[model samples]
Target: MLGVLSAMLCCGAVSAQQHEVEMIPFGNMDQWIDRQIKESGIIGGATKNVYAIGPTATVTETKAYKNMGGSPWATSNVMARVAGITKTNTSVFPEKRGDGFCARMDTRMESVKVFGIVDITVLAAGSMFLGEVHEPIKGTKNPQKMLNSGIPFTKKPIAIQFDYKVKMSDREKRIRATGFSRITDVEGKDFPEVNLFLQKRWEDEKGNIYAKRVGTMVVRYYTTTDWHNNATYSIMYGDITGDPAYKAHMMRLQVEERYAVNSKGESVPIKEVAWGTEDDVPTHLLLQFTSSHGGAYIGSPGNSLWIDNVKLVY
Candidate 1:
C-alpha cells in the first residue's frame, strides 16, 4: 500500500520535448510577440550576426599561434618606427644626431599669442621639435642669454615649454604623445629618469619636466577652423644632467595618453592610438608643424633667431 502511495505521488521522468512559455513579464500580448521572439534569444532564431572578439592583446594570441613575448619596446624583442611624411628634399632634421625628418619655418603667421597654437607650432619648429634656439621675447630678449649673462636666477636652470596642434577630425577625437627616452648610453644598457619640461626646449637645465601635468593636451578650440587659435602643448624630452643617452637613437616610443570629457560624462584619451615615430601618414600620428607665427625673443643684436633641434627621448 505504501509503495502504491509513493507511485501515485511520483511520476516517471519524461523525454525532453519542445514547448513554449510566456516570455513577457507583462505586456499587450501578440502586439510585441515578434519583438519578444527577437529578444528571447531562441536557438536558431533570427539573431543578428555577432562574433566574440577578444581584447587586442588577447586577439593577438591563440592556441594555433605562437605567443609573442612583449610590446615593441620589450627587451626580449623591441621594434622602432619613424615613418610618415615622405623624406622630401625640403625635409630637414628636427633633432640633432639623426637623419630624415624635414624641418623648416612655418611662415604662416605674422604674430603669435601666449599659449596659442601658432606659438606652440613655431616653438616646435624653432626649438624643441627642431632647433633648441635661444630666442628671447620681442622687447624682452634673452631668456637663455640672460641666464648666461652672469645673472643670479636667470643663470639658474630654465623650465622647458611646448605648444602644438593635433589635427582634429570633423568628428570628436583622442590623442597621445610618446617618445623614446633619450638613450644616454646605449652601449651601457642603461637609462636615466625621463624628464619633461614646461616648454619643449632647454640647451642645458634641470627644470622639473613632469611636475605640472602628465599626458595632457590642451584642446584650444573645438571647431576645425576655430574661433580660438590652435592648441599649444609641449614637453622637454632631454636629460637635465646633459648626458649622451639624451642623443641616442630611440628604438621605439613610449607615449602616455590623457583624457577629456565629452557631451556625455564619458571621457577618453586624446588619442585612439598614441603618436609614435611611424611613417604612415593618416594612421601614423605626428605633431607636424603645419604653421606658426611668434618665436623666441633671441638675444641677438639684430638677426631674427630660428627654431631647430626638436626631438623625442625616453
Candidate 2:
C-alpha cells in the first residue's frame, strides 16, 4: 500500500513573495466525522470509534463510509468485515492546536484475539490523503486495491504549505506484522513523510487508469522538530530523473501500480506510463502525509506526525 504513491523531494528554500495561498477544504484539520461501530460478538463485542476528516457530524451506523460534506480527504482509519466478523482500526485523531485542531497520526501495533486463543497482530501507520478509502475492508490481501488514491485536480500549484511536527521512532530497523504472518525485521530506519504528485491521467476501454508524472514534491522527516508554521515545499515539474536532487529510492515512478475505481465502477490499476514534460498541465493530483515511510503493516511503534493548516501556494 505504501508503494501506491511513493515519491520524495527535499525542502525548497523558496522566498515568500507575491504568493497566493488557497486552503484545501477541510484541510485545516479542525472538523471531523465521528463513527461509532460495534465489533462482532465473536471478536469481543465492543464499540469503537473511527474518525474521518469532514464536516462535523456523528455516524452510528456500520455501513461503508463515503466522503462527506464535499470534503476531499480520507484517513487510514477504517471499518473491516472479514469472514463475517466486523472490526475497527483507528490511528488518526483530531488534537487541539491553539484555537483549532490538527491531525495526529501514530504508528502503532493492533491486536485481535478470539476466545483467548486465536491471536493476530499487525502494525498500522496512520495516514491522510486526498482521495477515498473504500471501507468494510473485505480482507488483508492487496490493500492498495482498497483505495482510490487521488482526486481530479486540473490546476497546477507552485508548492504546498502546512504546519507540522513529528516524533520519530528512532529505531535502527523497522518491523512488519501482517497479523497472519510472524513479525519480521526490515532494514533501514522509519521516518514520517509527506508527498504530492500531479499527473495527466486517462482511462482505457478496458477500465485501466494510466498517467504520466507531471509534478512531484516529497519531504521526509529525519529527526524530531518543533511545530513549524507555514513551511512550504516546492513542486518539481516534469521529468526529474536527471535532477541532481533526485533520489531514485524515494522519487521514482511507483514500482507497484495504485488502484482507482473507474467510471465503470470497477477497481482497476493506475499504471504510471512515464514522466511528462516540464510544461505539462496535470489532470489530477495526489497528496499524502503519513507517520511511517514504509508501506502497509510495516513501521516502528510510537512514531507520530502532526499536521495542520494545509494550503497550496500559487
- TM-score of candidate 2 to 2 decimals: 0.95
lDDT of 1 by residue, 1-314 (tens): 97774553232111122322111111101111010111111212222211111112322211111112211110000011113111001111121212321122221112222333322111121221211111111222222221111001111111112222222222121111111222121112111111221221111132211111112111122222312121112322222123222222321122323222223433323332222111211211122222211223211111111222222211
Candidate 2 Cα outliers beyond 4 Å, as residue runs: 1-10
lDDT per residue as tens, model 2, 1-314: 54332333333635447999899999899999999999988878889989999999999998899999999998999999999999899999999999999999999999987875568898999999999999889988888899998999988899899999999887889999999989999999999999898989999898888899999888899999889999888888999998866778778998446788899998888889899998888988899999998889989998999999999999
Please, what is the TM-score per model? 0.16, 0.95
Please report, in order, the local distance difference test score of every candidate based on alpha carbons. 0.19, 0.89
Worst 10 residues of 1 by lDDT: 71-80
Superpose all Cα atoms of candidate 1 onto the true structure and report the RMSD in Å to 1 decimal.
Answer: 30.7
